[model samples]
Target: MSEALVAAETPGTGIEPVPGVSGARQFWRRLRAQRAALVAAAVVALLILVALGAPLLTAIEGQDPTTYHPSLIDSARGGVPIGSFGGIGGHHWLGVEPQTGRDLFARLVYGARVSLGVAFAATVIQLLVGVVMGIASALGSGWVDQLLSRITDIFVAMPLMIMALALLAIVPSSFPRPVLVTLVIGFIAWGNIAKIVRAQTLTLKGLDYVSAARLSGWGTWRIARRELLPGLAAPIITYAAILMPVNISIEAALSFLGVGVKPPTPSWGQMLTAADVWYQAAPQYLLLPAGSLFVTVLALTVLGDGVRTALDPRAASRLSIGTGRKREAKAAKGETEAGKSASAVGKAATEAGNGTTEAGKEGSA
Candidate 1:
């Protein structure tokens, strides 16, 4: 017989080994089981698509972000859109801006490109700096480690928003606003990640495998690349996912404050800045960008949480809980059926004995 068959036929030794799944597969399985998280992932994906294909989408709608249609605005009422819902109609799917009469739909998708792009770019910078600093601090000697630690503490203690505002205000207007915002945010906001990386690196460096690699005379870079990076990836990814939404909000806030992306480039925050005064006259002008920001932030937050849960081996998955509940229900139903069967059997047996007693009495009589 084949070894497989023989093993199957044997007792403990014959049991077939269950194939182990890859980490990515396990993470995806857990993530897919969460309906809200899955929906959020879909929404995030759609937003990305919208951001990437902004030009195409706008072209399809036959609208442009910069072009102003003054005719659509009611001059009598402080430049409110002529029609209801912010002048939403066949020509403008979302509606027009209050005074400019610029297509909101076109600007929205383009704004997504700026907002998400900056967030992603800034996150990349933060991650790179954080991971390097963290690894260096953990792997370095006593003095090296102390220096980096002190620096990290200083950064942690600093007020980030004030620093960002000062830096942004000092920068020359000749510099590109989007790039300036990205650089400022990326450089200033890496302290938390650095701290997290440092803690994780310290813990990981003491593990057996890391020590083994060190004993084997692996260079620092080699050890980091081969031994440490694999261990660091999960936490790094989890943190980055959570950090992106914050970056988006920060970028939006800066723009709303007039320091972010300039006019004509289009940004959600910039749109809000313009729409603030017209909230009552044209609520759609305010609502469109606000709703988009809300949805984007909400989706990102949910997706990030889902990722964290999926990546954490110790965390109980919702899917497992659901399945366990189903199993328990099935067991309870089976027990109930068994109980009914036992009662029916007892009733029949009692009836038989009673009949026998009556028949005996009749015969004796």
Candidate 2:
């Protein structure tokens, strides 16, 4: 088929394809059409930047996460901040913590680092373990496949919270809390992805190219790498994007429960733990971390949904906003066309009326 024909046929494929344009460019164009996704992506990017630049940001404000400003808090009033909005003022940006009087803004920015970093690191680990185990289960001999499948089933059956608590409790405090949390979340949470990968790999394993690679005496690893990996990339990426936010929430929950990150390290969840009692007295302290967590999770979720739709445009059915916008655009176009036609008809009718009036006057003359 000609390139023009191929390009013309692609609009029905959910990606607008221009002649000579690569698939990646087409995918990007489709993604850009999702406004919510774009905004969410921007939010996520800003968060990452904030997390990365936390130290500099704190330094610029001449504040650190651990500093105490005793004067900012009212010792007489049960450690409540003296000023309004958690003692927000010139020296304190987001305000000082209730009792310790630590810079809330500084701790918030620093907390972003722990929360984002642990989630990101854990996701990477999960992706690696899931993909490897999934591929292995698919390509292995019958007994090996059975063994791996059973192992995956066991992991899936284990209660995540119980396992996490048990593991976190037994681990020594000498170990870095952030690293421990990441490892716990990553190692325990990969079962779902592994199951997904196994099913996908099995489907791909039966494809003609994969069989041909095997027929050519290629090793299992080589066949998987050369024939199956490309086919698996899209689903893997979509799942991984969706998985990160879940990991983030899990980390936060663990920290809030007092088994995640320790104090002075600055985690959103840990901050929330401390702020629970101060909710009535210092709502800003609670609201700050709570709001941050809510926004982060929401943005990540939207971004993940966008990625899934971008990778497989058929999934755009789930994005009501995108479909709604398309509907509105079509309606607007119809209205515009209708108005233009109505105006043209009116113009023609007025001209005809003028002609008739002129003919009657000529007859009278």
Candidate 3:
């Protein structure tokens, strides 16, 4: 009745069309099917919400993270104060700092803003550059592909950490720290994403939909955008999921090294660095930020793994092999029916000619 239904019903090609669900729907469904990914997603979502709602949370706590509480510090306790590492039930929920009695909870909440923002920004840039370069490399031929491929290879060959350090050295520390860090990390780390995209594009560009678009006089960029891009979504997202934790780690490392986001601007890495010396006095100082980083990275990594496994068609093939076979069998049945109809037509024609001859002979007799 409908064009979509007609198309869905029609079977012309050897490759069977997967019915019912659209690609986006299928991708989401697959993602939902992954239990580990779902849990990781929830954790990541909670982290993001916490990061986004930092100001509100701080306001609710009535604690200014940057404000020093010299009164809260007890000099007799060997720099460990009353509020520092004091159990959860007080005005300072996560306790206060050792020297400067800043609220740890407020600082942690605010620090998440910097960490998530930088990581997400860098990841966005990485995806944009990497996906474009990769698709362009796949679309081009001859010298174009060669040049792009060589450029990607060169980037991959370089020691990215060293390159980032060198680049950061030139940037003024007082410059927009998060933006600079994001650019440096994004520009330096897109090689792996490009490689993954390039390989995926190379495979996808050869598909029937892409070929059909090409034959219908679509420009390279148009075909790439409309035809190849959707197919590349899963891998691109999967790569991105993998890249996020790496980006976060890089930001943390730079902050820990003191070249990253300067003082007064809180970061988990900076907190950890500050807390290192206080480990002997208050273990919570070292544990808080370190534990946060660990959990964030671990959650992201698990999410990535879950996404990879969920989207892997090869892995899922066993479950759907029977359905695939049924499609093949249906196609085969259609062919068999076509052959039977052709044979029936030929037989009927033969019988009609025989009847006509017999009538002519009987009439003549």
Candidate 4:
């Protein structure tokens, strides 16, 4: 019984202790504590799942979204039509479109595919262009940097929307494929990213690691790939997150202007265009797509903010208790050292006083 009690009292003798927290673990622990980041992650995950699984879900309804249904309302009298409001004694949940009588829910689902696809593709292209241009300019001597910087400046000063509009006006409204629109947006948007990447590269190139690599006879490409790129990871991730929303917004705006993703494609922007006439009566039509865009953009912005905070060394330090604990430990060490000095001084003073008194007594004697 006593052995059992001792064994019970002993703290997990067979179990290993938890490992010490690492920098990554500490950062993740801090991030998890943030309520906004948690919520934003959840929302973004849900959106991604919806975007990817849209086709599967739409097929389960036994409805063809692309096919036109002329008498959707009349059909709903017997059975629910694709877009009929569920609780309103109709087969459709969101109500049928007045002109085409298409399913609103189905269209929204399909639209997600278009919006997210374009945003991702454009972001990737922008990153590639920006990273290459920025690194090239940073590695090159004065003339090359100056030329690239001037070109970047020129593009930055130009109105992007105006340029896009002029280009679309000169060319056909419909492109050969969706990729063409994505390429156009990506090519135009890369100027901003190039400037950002250039600035970062300039700062990183002066670091000791970069200098050491150069001193070791590493070429520019090797130095950039090994030394500079690793340092740029945080900013690259942050920039990518922020750029996604911008691309989405640009795609929507172009679509709204009748220059992006031709009609009948079921884009959120195209949905908005269709809802313009019914703005006063059936505001839900406009509100649905607009609301989706607003939420998606807002979610991306929040996620980007979270990523920025997480990636920033200063912000991460502020979030972690490590900084405070380290400061306290340093102060304690300092105090200990001070106490030792005070004790040494007091001992020396006592000894000197004793010696002086003893000498005085001896002289008096």
Top-lDDT candidate index? 2
Per-candidate local distance difference test: 0.84, 0.87, 0.80, 0.73
TM per model?
A: 0.82, 0.85, 0.78, 0.75
Candidate 4, which segments miss by more than 4 Å at Cα? 1-23, 73-91, 313-365
Q: Arrange candidates by lDDT, highest first: which order? A: 2, 1, 3, 4
lDDT of 4: 0.73
Inter-residue clash pairs, candidate 2: none
lDDT string for model 3 (1-365, tens) is 11111122223323233566565554556567655678989999999999999999889888877998877777787557674254344577888888787888998988889998999999999999999999999889878999999999998888867877787888877788878888988888888889998998898778787788899999999988877777777777778888899888999998898778776788998898788888877888789889999999988987887666555533432223456578768989999999999999999999999999999999999
Q: State the displacement of the C-alpha of residue 361, model 3, in Å, after optimal TM-score superposition.
A: 57
| Candidate 3 segments whose C-alpha is farther than 4 A from its true place | 1-19, 75-78, 84-89, 316-365
Q: Which digits, one per residue and each the tens of the lDDT, describe model 4 over residues 1-365?
A: 11111111122111122245444554465456555777887888898898898888667654545765666644544333333242222345466565566766778878888898889999999899888888888788999999988887887787878887777667764564356668888888788888888898998888787798899999989988978887777778878989999989988898888777776787888788878876664666788889999999988887777766655524332222555468667877998999999999999999999999999999999
Candidate 4: deviation at residue 139, Å? 1.0
Across 1-365, the per-residue lDDT of candidate 1 in tens digits comes to 01111111222111232346555665666567667789989999999999999999999999999999999999898898988888899999999998889999999999999999999999999999889998999889999999998998888888877888888888898899989999998988888899998898898789898899999999988988888888888888889989989999999999999888899989999899999998888888888899999999999988888777666634443334566568667877998999999999999999999999999999999
* TM accuracy, model 2: 0.85
Q: Write the per-residue lDDT of candidate 2 for residues 55-87, one digit (tens) a residue.
A: 999888899999888988899998998888888
Residue pairs with colliding backbones in model 3 are none
Give the Cα error of residue 226 in candidate 1, in Å.
0.5
